[model samples]
Target: MSATEVKLFGKWTYEDVMLSDLSLVDYIAVNKAAQSFLPHTQGRYQMRRFRKALCPIVERLCCSIMMHGRNNGKKLMAVRIVKHAFEIIHLLTDKNPIQVFVDAVKNGGPREDSTRVGSAGVVRRQAVDVSPLRRVNQAIYLICTGARNSAFRNIKSISECLADEIMNAAKESSNSDLAAQLAVSAATFQRMIAQDAWKFLKYMWVNSVASDIPPLTHPWAWGLPVTASLTFSQGYAIKKKACFAAKVSFLHRINEHVLEEFYKDYRVDDAAMHVGESAARVILLH
Candidate 1:
């Protein structure tokens, strides 16, 4: 019979039937023809072509089964046709056949060991101490720069060397400032340096005012403030003040909109008014 005239019967749906009755060769030929037309088209055209190709093979197999009954010969044929039908469906669907095959293999393979164990108590992470190193380093840098004075060159050089040693200790101790301090005993600054424990040396040098150098107390002098608070309008006013402080006289001549945008970008937080404290304080309070 022609491909379009064949009809699949209901018995073809059985799970464990024989393959011989299904007429495997004819099934393959029809399925091959169906697959060829699937490339250049999609949607309804694809669905129609698949159904047309598959229905005929299914119909012939069904007719064979109905004629032969439930004997071993017919059962074998039915099984083969059902298997072929499954393959055809797989090829036409969106499912990835390779992934499906791999998943099937994995699912059917051996399983890993599954055993229960008693729960352990919760463990807390240890906190690191950083204050000692910060204090020591701050002291060292202060002494080295002689608080940024040009007179005490020798003392500055000695302080810089000590600072370098402290930095190395910090690295070796994995940022453990406490361990660094313990490495260098607290008593007798000269003895501490003799033992290569320059931790307290920087502190001692900083406290000594004999060098006629002022102490650098404000940490904010090193960088911009972290936070500052001012209302939108107040922030703009502070920016204008800072501009004047910097001797930018042209700021008075600039447009208000441009000034507002500039302030929005550079204005510090209320809390971090380190460099702009005076202007920020006046504007925010007012």
Candidate 2:
């Protein structure tokens, strides 16, 4: 029989498995010649530079699994572990194991990385493009490494951990969470600036007119109003690009009182005006 006629481990077939990512089609070598029941290439790819890219992707994964701890120098053990993991992936996801594995590689691969450059202690980090072959190699290495680490202390077996990691990686990866985190971070930075500004203004109010202004009544009597108003103004100004829900969420987190008053007094369009006037009255009066 030809190489294509053999099933992987006498069970899974590579018939319909295709690379959905067109850019990675050339880099990820998946074809009849590369598929085999036993994916051992016997280090022939290592004899020539760049020949490793022609090796089967599953063989690369098996080699990565053999990198650390007790699994080191044990190719058959790594192969058995990967085979069991693929079976688990098939049972849970009900999809082709090869397709899931390919998607995981596509999602987990890093496109760019930083390297140190320059000479004589003037070195700086510069971003560099990761070659396609290296990207696939790194992705397999990381997936196997993560599976090993997770299985180290936990009661879960390596096969289960590996299956879970591959399935999670294959899920659609997006930047929506990152964008939300950035919005919150920007709002936090604005709050810090508002706090500093409020402190300076409070100092000026007290020192400039100690005789004109009476002693304080309560802690939130005057300071909180001024601070909240200033925070709203500055945070709104800084987060104009953020979504309206994010802005409201920031305001609600910092001060619910200000948020309620915000809706009651000026709504949204006239918020800056109300905040400016409130702060001016508090600062200019004293």
Question: Considering every candidate listed, which one attains the maximal lDDT?
Answer: 2
Candidate 2 deviant stretches above 4 angstroms: 1-4, 172-286
* Candidate 2 steric clashes: 0
Cα lDDT tens digits, model 2, 1-286, are 4544767787777888878777778767678778788767686888888888888888888888887676578999889889999999999989988889989888776665545678988974453556778778777876787787788899999988888878877784431112222222333333323334334333444444345333343323333333454676654433332222222222323345544554454343232323333323322232
Candidate 1 lDDT by residue in tens digits, 249-286: 22233456644543455442221222222322232333
Poorest stretch of ten by lDDT in candidate 2: 175-184
Give the alpha-carbon lDDT of every model.
Answer: 0.30, 0.62
Worst 10 residues of 1 by lDDT: 105-114
What does each candidate score in C-alpha RMSD?
Answer: 34.3, 13.7
TM-scores of the candidates in the order shown:
0.13, 0.59
Instruction: For candidate 2, list the clashing residue pairs, or say none.
Output: none
